[model samples]
Target: MKQTIRLEQFERADIRSALAKMNRGIERESLRITSEGQLATTMHPAALGATLTHPLITTDYAEALMEFITPVSTSITTTLAQLRDVHRFTYQHIGDEYLWPLSMPCYLNATSDIRLAQFGKSHVGRMKTVYRQGLTHRYGAVMQTISGVHFNWSVSDELWPLLAAEEGRENNADYRSERYFGLIRNFKRWAWVIPYLFGASPVLCKSFLKHSSADLDFHELSSGMVYVPHSTSLRMSDLGYTNKEQAALKITYNSLDDYVDGLRRAVFTRSEQFADIGVQTGDKWQQLNANILQIENEFYSPIRPKRVADSGETPTQALERGGIQYIEVRALDVNPFSEVGITAEQMRFLDLFLLFCLFTESPELSIECQQATEKNVNKVVLRGREPGLTLMDEAGEYSVQERLAHLFAEMAKIADVLEAESSAYHRALQSFAPAISNPDATFSAKLLRMYEEASKIFQHVGMRFAVEYRDRLKNSGYEFYTEADFQKMAAQSLAEQAEIEAQDKGSFGDFLAAYFEQALDKKKRA
Candidate 1:
């Protein structure tokens, strides 16, 4: 059944303040994962700069905290950025990757374009080496960045017994069954829960851009992510709300440039026009980019997961081959600085770089590449410590050094062309080219070169800031946040959902009543 929640009479500024505070919370929570004795950044890099030693923790701790937060509306009024335009403007990726009605690869190649494959195979091994070199040269860590993005999950004391029992089981099937799809299933039924419910009165949505034969769906990746209010340093309107509600806006962007501009207007605005208005948009795009690149299944596609001819193998073999799913890019953190969490300069560079991915694509989705990507994801998430780890790409694998050099040279070429053509975006891309070209000498490298530079405490600030911002919006402005508000919204949404679910069946109210009654009966018996 679809469940919706509304935030009524909610102000926006308060929510913004709360979210800004949350940055610190994320940093603090990550501290628990680091080795107690170590004082370096938990985010490790190939070198001390990019990677840092950290510990293992579950998201339950974070989820519990989020529950206390509020949500808001974004569809109505959140003037996003529209900074200096760039060349080759393109917005949301135009691809055959839709959520439903399965959009698969077509002109880009359904099975695989031989021309692209030929180009890819020719450079597969070399590309692999360059990917490593390029990453290390720039960041020193094989894994680029740990994303601020997140999915939601809940596990309470009541489930401890089941958790304990599941650990004892040989495989994690039982645990997976119980926890995996709860959030995704919820999204499929109800999506509008995003804006209609989020406001000073009520409150806060994920999807994929691709369609793999038998891979993970978009919802599966970021189900816990609900619409929290989005406010930037530019406009703390969201902070006006007392409730800690976050929100999202589904906008139409013509090109990547448009998207970047949108981000600037939405979250990262600090112009003279709004000078009278106090806003606090930070330079979150840099951080957001780092996070997005590493999403489980976004940019890098090492091994294709599809129902290949099921060959008989060991117990694990069957599950792996048949387990067709792709990674998705969600869990993106809102950059209070930018509308969509990134900047124009950053976007300009990213467009050129990401395009290179499409141009020099690989033919064989090698297991090694997939493994490398997995390693990269872990390395970035847990701190990139694996020495000499390679990034998967075309032109064969190269040591980190070799791969980076080639990228530097190629980027230079792209930059020069843009400069001559006088493309505004190309110029932006060109400017960053030099810095990124010599990533070996940038702050990115410093991050990996040094250990424990930033305090974990700072990381946790993002979440707390989110909550506080919501509170401010509700208290100072027209927004409101309280468990009571959630209960009311949830109840209404749940009721509506129940009705829909009962279609062609029994009454949804009856189902809930019986379910609750049975639960009470079970409790009494116990």
Candidate 2:
């Protein structure tokens, strides 16, 4: 049963070359704010490009919430440089608005102030906006406005053959998908370390709680700031992305089929709660449908298996045609200390952790174990920096400090092999090793301390970083992409969006029916 490969398995040339050439991409979201530190009421800047067809820049839930995407590359420094260039280019077009630095948002009065992201007149573009409308009706706009960074990672194809041989399985596409699922299972079991080491949202503005119905005990601070003591990231807590409705779905990751089938079922399954909201009122559509999910992406998780879908193809359809291509890590908070919301060291650490996950023993995750894993993450999100905190594991309860040390020791072994090509892997591990024993040295702890020293005014500390980063990026200029390159891309995106609109030939109802029909057809084939 222990046929899993060891850290010492990198002996062959193919394996060694594969280990050195893993690819990574980044997607970071930040809200546009005014000089007074209020949410920008303006529409998405036209100079950036159409939100629907843009390759590099787009909008998230709100019109003011900008999402920047970096193309995939093997080098971590290049990935970071692309992100920085995106920020620098955006600053030039945004006029007076500053990109909000913290994961938590600025002041807000009500949901109406937060406009849904607008796409062009094309059917597909309209569907994207309608999805956001569904989210606002279902989860409220405030919660959806919280931002974070997503890391998309995949190992080399050559490494997969080595893994398939070690497991005594055929070197096929399905085996690759299954092994990626195994990595995901292990990632869930040990993901708490991420928020502990890189979390930056220790406090939030009181405006975030204006529409909240949940009863949470929080200490109030001056200037409408409120927080839980010693919390690492309230953004990852129940207050943020943790949704009760999706939690009830219990999507399993035992295999690729299990994962895909669960998402498809959830999309088709009706929900009484959503039914009450109603799908449409006359010509205006309020939401997509009265289902547990509007689409596959509605079923939220800390991580997801992803494939780049072709035009008119659903995410599940793409996965069915081709096995999982990569895994997107969605647990990271935007690091306020960095101009780009993430550092090269953080990316290197993630690479080591993911490599460790691939090589570690990953058992099938049961329902009870899944719940326990979630509880572990929740504890870390709320009280990770608290002294003597313990978490539940398969082997009874264990102190977080002890578990982190053991995990890091294991990661160091993988880093040892990886550093043969570049010392960046080992250097990144050493950078974060101190946070294991000394909780005060962690990012969350430092953010909390600075917030308190600023007289408990959340924005006092956040706005400072926002202003500083804005000026630095504006003056630093571009790192990778030139101004002409950005302008051409933006113009081309707008032209592509216009062509899509011009090519429309069907009614809105017909378009909706066809889309749903395709989804149902894929499920039937599965």
Candidate 3:
């Protein structure tokens, strides 16, 4: 079946006006560590509020690893402003600690040294910690500590019905869901471009390679810096967040139902490798379960179809109740060049690229095509800017520059269709063209140049940026939120967390039983 409407149809629909009204949110993750660049031993700052209930600040895998989330905003200005406010407030609260300014982590001693994020005595809170524990057991703690940015985006509500009509489909949940799946397929195909343009994690501390089995021909430089020549984002490569077991999952984006089904099975199916870790090591819980996935969130993908879950609902349940609310772009590396880890121009370009994906014809992805996508992504991640490098496509091999040139041409049409601040989109696209023509213009290449010129290691550079960013935040002041507002939210979040803990009436064992039973029942019905 024809999966997507033609580009000509999109022009006829005149989606330009509707495209200008899209909403976006950003989730940025960073490690809060000591001045000496060691992981912070102190607990999550009390002034930052309860990690369980705080709307903006939370811990990811490690207690020291902080995640800043921005509320949905219609404009990149508001989104970035809110993100800065969160950072400013956080810097003010964290004592003697600095936010790690790079996507790759700083110096680390051992896996045991990294403390797991602790939640209060509530079962749900404990469950969250246990899930992280599972991640640690499956993937080493070093991999979990590596942080990045996630851009959550959705088109305006009005655009969806119009898009559905263009495809000769009903303006309903299924139609919307299918169209989103189409967007996802195209995103996967073109996502390699992201790393080529914005990837910043080119080098790393030799300590990170301690637990890794990567056999790349790395050049060992002075001060323990190790890197592969022309590498873009080691953070997105096999050296970063990835799993061999997941490769076997072969999760399909052909339909929402298929995607959810694949996730459900992963969560339920037991892994013999993980069984060795055991569910519990004596009194302490080693992990939530021995399943391949402890929860739906465990399935790591570069992009995900997301819906905000209601209270007491799982992610899968939320998607079942309401189709995808937004698409989360996870391929972004933390742009070390920006104080805030992302730029307004980058967001503008992303909007244009996503719109292009939505309007472009997306073929249903097969297993072979999926492998091709992975190959292309790895090519970009490892050696993207290499001159004369070619990427595979159904049409056959094409040079990286040629493919990007073609994509930018399409994106230019998308930029024109977008009404507000369209020049930002054009400028962003224009900036990437040079990176294709001259690899040295790429962020990774530029970062390497900076490292070489400064004669300092990644850790020293990261610390300098961290201090600079902290000072900038101190002077700039909050943009979207005030000190009083932050204090009020912090207090409220603590009280809510307390209330949740107080309301937990059942034992952890009973909670586990009920949760698994419900999941199994849901699977049977599906």
Number of clashes in every candidate structure?
A: 164, 0, 0
The models' CA-based lDDT, in order, is 0.24, 0.86, 0.85
Rank the models by TM-score, top first. 2, 3, 1
**Residue range 297-336, candidate 2, lDDT tens digits:** 8877888999888778889888887888999999999998
Sort by lDDT, best first: 2, 3, 1
Model 2 bad stretches (over 4 Å): 1-5, 166-168, 420-422, 456-459, 523-526
| Model 3: residues with Cα > 4 Å off, grouped in runs | 1-14, 456-459, 521-526
Please provide, for model 3 over 1-526, each residue's C-alpha lDDT reduced to its tens digit, 9 standing for 90 to 100.
1123345655753565776888999999999978898778788989989999999999999999999999998988899999999999998889879999899998888888788998888999999998898888889888998999999999999887777777688887677778888899999888898998999988888899997998886887676778789889999999887877788988999987888888889988889888899998665888888888888898888999998877767787777778888999999999998888999878988988888788777879998998898899999899987779988877788888877777778888777666566787889888777876788888899887767655553346778888899888878977889999999999999999999999998789788778777765442121
Expressed as tens digits, the lDDT of each residue in 1-526 for candidate 1 is 1112222211343432221111100110111111111112212111111010011111111111100111111111111111101000101111111100000101111111111000011122222223333233223221121112221112222333443453474323333322222222222111111111111100011111121121211221122211111211101112111111111222111222232233323322222322332212351111112221211112221111111223122112222323211111121222322222334444344333322332232232233533343333323222111245343333454443344445545544444433323265456555544432343333223322221222232232223333343333333322232334333444454454344334424433343234323322211100
What lDDT score goes with residue 312 in model 1?
Answer: 22
Q: State the local distance difference test value for candidate 3.
A: 0.85
Displacement of residue 433 (Cα, Å) in model 1 is 4.0
TM-score for candidate 2: 0.96
Output the worst ten-in-a-row residue range by lDDT, candidate 3: 1-10
